[model samples]
Target: LNEIADHDDEGAALQWLRRNRRAKLWISPVTLAEVLEGAEDVDAVRAYLSRYGWQGIHRIQAETAARLQRRTKHRLGENDAWQAAVAECMKARVVGHDDAFKRLAAGYEDYRP
Candidate 1:
C-alpha cells in the first residue's frame, strides 16, 4: 500500500500489521514511487514504514506496458495503469482506498494489498 492507500482510518494498515504481527508482504514499484517521491516527508514516511516487512517488486517492463495499453484500451490512465502493472508484475495486490482504483480493480482479480 502507498501513502494514499493508508488514508483509511488514518493508517489502519500499519495498525493492523502491528496488532496482527504479520510480516513479509509484497509491494509494487508504483507504490514505492509514491513512497519515495510523493510523500509529504520522506524521512517520516520511511520511519513509519520501517515497522513493516515491506518487500518491493519492480513493475512490468515497457513491453508489458504497451501490451497492457493494447489489452485494456479502457483509458485507465498511465499512472493508475502503471500502478496496476506493478501490482500485477509483483503478483501483489493493489491496496488503496481511492474509490477510482477500487472501482477499477473490481472488474479484475486483485487483492487489497
Candidate 2:
C-alpha cells in the first residue's frame, strides 16, 4: 500500500515493482483496507491496486494470524499479524518497510528507501 502511495518513483518499492514486473504480485484484504483508509482518492488507489491479484483471508490465515500474535506475545499488531499470515499462507514474501515484520518468522522483503 505504502509503495503504491509513495510518489517517489525511484523508491525501493517502486524499483522492486519494476525489477519483478513478471512476478505474480498479490494484495491481501488487510492491505486493501489499509490502502483505502485515509486515502485522498479512493477510486484512483483502488484502480491502481486492481492490477494485483487479491488474496482473501480464510480460516487457515485467520488461525495463522492468531498463532503469530500469540507467539509474538501480542507484540505484533493485528493488521501486521494478518499480513504476515496471508504471506505465510500463500508462500509469498511480505514486501514493505515495516520493521515489525522482523518479529514474525515469515518470508519478508524489506523495501525501505
Candidate 3:
C-alpha cells in the first residue's frame, strides 16, 4: 500500500490489489506480523489493517496452513505457507512477486502485477 501510495516502481501490485478490492480478501496472521514488524508507525499499520479489514486466524486456518507447509513440493517459509493457506481457504488468488509465492503459483493463480 505504501508503495502504491508513493507511486513506487512496485505500485503495480498495489494497483492490482485496489482493482480487486471487492474480492473477499484474506490476510494471514503471519503476513500481518511480517508487515507490522517492519513498520515504523503503529498508527499507520492500524489504519492499513482497518482499510483492508483482515480476517483473523482460526484454529482451522492454522491447521490448514500447517498441512500446506507439510504437503507442498516447494520449501516455503512460515509466512508464505500461512498466506497460501489463507488464500486457499478463501478461494482467492495470491498476489505477490516473491519466489516462494511464485513456486506455489502452480496451485494458486498468480496475480502477476
lDDT of 1 by residue, 1-113 (tens): 35333444446555555554653555545556767776666666666566545544343445555666777546556767676666566555555555545544543433335
Greater-TM-score candidate between 1 and 2:
2
Better of 1 and 2 by lDDT: 2
What is the Cα-based TM-score of model 2? 0.86
Residue 93's lDDT in candidate 3: 65
What is each predicted model's overall lDDT from 0 to 1? 0.55, 0.80, 0.67
> Could you say which candidate leads in lDDT?
2
Q: Worst ten-residue run, lDDT, model 2?
A: 1-10
The true-versus-predicted C-alpha distance at residue 35 of model 2, in Å, is 0.9
Q: Give TM-scores for every candidate, taking all chains together and pairing residue i with residue i.
A: 0.55, 0.86, 0.72
What tens-digit string does per-residue lDDT give for candidate 3 at 1-113?
A: 44533436556666676677776666656767776676666567656666564766777778988887777676588777777777777766677767777666555654554
What TM-score would you give candidate 3 relative to the actual structure?
0.72
Q: Model 3 Cα displacement at 64 (Å)?
A: 1.6
lDDT of 2 at 39: 73
Clashes within 3 Å, all models in order: 0, 0, 0
Cα-lDDT of candidate 2: 0.80
lDDT of predicted model 3: 0.67
